[model samples]
Target: MDTGRRAGEPLVRHTVSPHLTRLLIDAGTAAGLDRGQVMRLPGFDTLSVDPVRIPTATIMRTWEAVGGALMEVGGVARVMELWRPGTLGVWDYLFTAAGTLTDALRASGLHFAVIADPVDAIAVTRDGAGVTVSWDGPYRDHPSYPLIAEFVPSMFQTVASSGAGRPLTPVQVRLPHRAPLSHAALCELYGTRNVEFEAGAPSITFTEADAATPLPQSDPALAAILNDHARITVETARPVVSWLDRFHLALETAVGDGPPELARVAHRLAMGPRTLQRRLNEAGTSWREELERLRQRRVDQYLRETSLSVESIAARVGYSDPRALRRAIHRWYGHSPRTVRQNPD
Candidate 1:
């Protein structure tokens, strides 16, 4: 049976893992932006960014911009810090539970919905002399896609080393796409071979001998904690959905030559300004913070993913003066808009 695909309640909303955030901050500083800028983001209370209403494409661009800076700053050590303890804890649990590397990956997929932004789906199947572990996902067309691709192989290596009780050599990798300049990125990130795009499916085939290893029994206390963590994390998804709905309505109304004020948004939601403020406060956020966060997310996405000039981007994001927008970008990312556009992370 495909235990990985069994239906269940959804996991938590996508969160920015603490480790990833640390890496991004370090990278930003390396790219000449102030490292503190990352902390200044209104909602970055913890390592996780709650209620991530922004599209995945925008998130990818932001990562690329910061990633380049991180690479320039500290290389792999800095990048490695992006893995959060909770995320690693989950990975550890899976590795200890599965009988083989392939089985471990399948377990990871089964639990991936617990993450804020799930990146890969894993499956295992039998072939003539071995087992194949297949990994697949929607690869958004972004420069950072290649960078993120490295996470899979790195993860596999980490598990293999832990299970083997020593460091392991890199294994061959199979990609689902043609080799792009970014393919070189996979080499640097994963230290594995990158096969050209294949139509059958993307997988890593290994001997069945690797599959016979038995996993340690799961610790009851740890399993309980993990289950609780997944539940609490999933609860955050509700707020994100509410935020998206509210933000979308606000954007639609603001586009009709209307003012972008809290009162305006409140009216559209059929509530008084005071009532809206109370509700937002009750939800543990505020109108100003939401507006700024949404704007920053959108601006970052536009700068990294599109060829739109600064002027056009500024206008689209509700800024009439491109210079002011540049300053805002600097405050948020600790670099000028031009720098971000020139070398995306």
Candidate 2:
């Protein structure tokens, strides 16, 4: 049998287990919206045939719709409230079956690609006495990114705390987005109030001792079986490139030495400058827009997370003129660089 995927197939950049999509839809229903209303929201029309995977882009669009629908009802808090552990299918099971939080996190990290794509964007590292997990990617531009940003760490807390049989607070938490309207919900979820906004990326850190604590539900026999299944799943569904993610990767590399030039990015992507521009246009964005957004995020991070001078930050982000950077800061944030740095809230 020819088991290879068909030719001329499009690459799905990212995907989630169908259960995650169902969770999003269910959140909308729990918020008093009819099921039809959620399904009618953009990107729910395509049904998943694989039973395990659903396009994450579809979920992203649906998230925006659900957030808008729930804006008046309860917002992201309601979604988090409705979310329950063990609803994530195999991904969740891998956690409970593991011997300790550290083992579970490592296993989850290894099999994450089975549930989502662009697997390299996530990093799991261990310091002397702490383990840190972080996700840094082009996903910040998506409207639903902030919602997912907050939701993910909270979910991690819930799962880890429950599995460990004790509350394990993160040593630190960092988010790239601004703080939400209600900190109460977040404080309650993480079991800690030490959350920093406008960070370079989304990350959570826990002490190594906490991570090594054994879980009561650990079942090595079942874990071995699930590990085999996860390995098979990841091997079967290889990571596929998304053009948007590729562009982001190229842009990030290009911006290291200096400003990101369209020609340089195009060459990096093995496409002509014109073709890249056309692709961006078709995606409802342009090179200038993405460049500006990237610069804004970098500038914001530098201002909030560093003690760098405005001139230094401007040069770092490719602005030759410090005054120009100041004007951009005012335009984007309605404040001066100094003000933004001091009062990120």
Candidate 3:
């Protein structure tokens, strides 16, 4: 809902997502912000605020400060209570009609289009043997992107676990360039291997095998049930997870060549190292863990899916010494790089 701030008013009057309003409440308390002051701000209605009326920039700022606080407080689940039941039925129809993950993404993009806060764009591409689904648009500040990114994975996971389903493993993301701090929050949330910066696109990638897997129709009754409640869970997780996805993409793009030092990452994120650490901690992860996770995942993917040698793969993923890289790989997967390459596991 629009807060109706006039020209020259402080940015506080910007429209805000209901999810973000909750996050601000949590963050303000954690930051020692006075609750009375927050509630006094224009458009401070805790309930019934229009999602579209909230400005994207305001949401971004709130997310940076709050990180995953809303999800931690169950704000997302609570927000889901507002969605119309028909929303889920519509999503189910799209899920069934789509033939692949790529297809599902495209359909989702279209479905969001009728709404005022639709996804910017969804693009499908082939990287090596995998398919990438890139989503970009004004969602930079909206809670939907993060929520969608997080929930989509679960949706894929659910479909996969259901037997003969196409489960998605999130890969890289490309986010807008301006807000590095916002990107940091995103990286921690999605746990993706890479986060590209200021790229021409913002999207997620899926393996070809995963993308090609058909939707399971074996349990029509069960599918319908799951569909009915899909929006409920999606509403809760969208903001936090989507922000993380964008952050991961930014990190991947920045450090794609080598492991970025804390200072460098902090610089990219426009915050001091200490501040970055504090914010990351609030998000329930550390920079070191995120760096290592990206490295290990990239290393494994290269070894298993590509013909790149250990030395070459090491360099591509930012490792300088093949031996050192081997140690890292062993530590992560409990097997040597050569072993992995030979067996292609």
Candidate 4:
């Protein structure tokens, strides 16, 4: 972590493609480190190739690992160079499937939540001048924003240029923080002469004409499918006010008070436990499953974001014993509580 910025303390749960972690390992290897060295980093032993859930602190710590390795072996620029088309998994297809640069930009801003949304996200907005992307977030004060500054804009431009099938060079690069690299270095990396520093929100602008250019890989059908999938992924993540949602909400509200083998939750909702069980069954879930899911979510938060001891967390989550909490956490995450806490989901 850079000493210049404040520590990262994110308060919300967000997720990104696990391919980013896999690619980080590859990046370290490409930087001339042996794979084993990268593997030794905490949580790498269990990193998988799906969207990985994360807290605010975890992402900064990850970059601390990546940034240091890259700086030691290949300078900070190589870290930015490591990003490619599929770095974001399903979200990456929006580029190849989009009809035009404008379309791709629109798709990225709209469906970005399915991939790289943190507690807060850098909003992507396009105007007559160009598209503006702000890197301000909970991580805004993070020391690693310097590295994040280079990696994000570089990858964003690569995606934009690749999707446009033309050089979508930024007219100006506006940064929210001080530039760690030289102005000449920034210009060469972005192919932009105007690299503004400590400007407002970190941003980049493309020419209006470049934004309108058509992409060579455009496939309207593929774009539709990808968009539909993104929509569904985001929608399901939200708590809809359906019947099952009401039951889940009740369980969530009652959990803090204390959970009792699926307590008066059903009764409070004006239904018998059996009737609620039947409704949940029809919804393809059960009372126990929903309760477990609720406990799992709370337990994960307590474990990741707090210094609360396992026993304390267990009691708060209504576990009678820490052993039961351990078993339940393993059931939900397929890993022990210690392992889960180390990975920070």
| The candidate that achieves the highest TM-score relative to the unseen native structure | 2
Stretches of candidate 1 off by over 4 Å are 1-8, 11-33, 48-65, 71-78, 81-87, 118-120, 125-143, 169-171, 176-185, 197-207, 215-345
Candidate 2 per-residue C-alpha lDDT over 167-187 given as tens digits, one digit per residue, 9 for 90 to 100: 788988888877766666567
Candidates in descending lDDT order: 2, 4, 1, 3
Worst 10 residues of 3 by lDDT: 1-10
The digit string of per-residue lDDT tens for model 3 on 107-172 reads: 444333222133234455676756655554543323234443433333333323233343345566
State candidate 1's TM-score: 0.55
Per-prediction TM-score:
0.55, 0.62, 0.36, 0.59
lDDT of 1 at 175: 54
Q: Give a tens-digit lDDT track for model 1, residues 187-218.
A: 55545564445434455554565554454553
Name the runs in model 2 displaced over 4 angstroms. 1-12, 41-43, 46-52, 70-75, 180-182, 234-345
Q: How large an RMSD does model 3 have?
A: 16.3
Number of the predicted model whose lDDT against the real structure is largest? 2
How accurate locally is residue 202 in candidate 4, as Cα lDDT from 0 to 100? Answer: 65
Q: Which lDDT tens digits does candidate 4 get at residues 1-345?
A: 001111121211343434555666677678776777666643453355343333222344466556656756645467546667767666677877898766776676566655554444556667777756555554442334556666667766887776776767787788766655456767887887888887876667777777666788899999999888766555444311245545654664466555455548887678888888888899888877777765775576567644568887776666777899888887778998789879873
Question: Candidate 3 at residue 206, lDDT?
Answer: 61
- lDDT to native, each model: 0.54, 0.69, 0.49, 0.63
**lDDT-superior candidate, 1 or 4:** 4
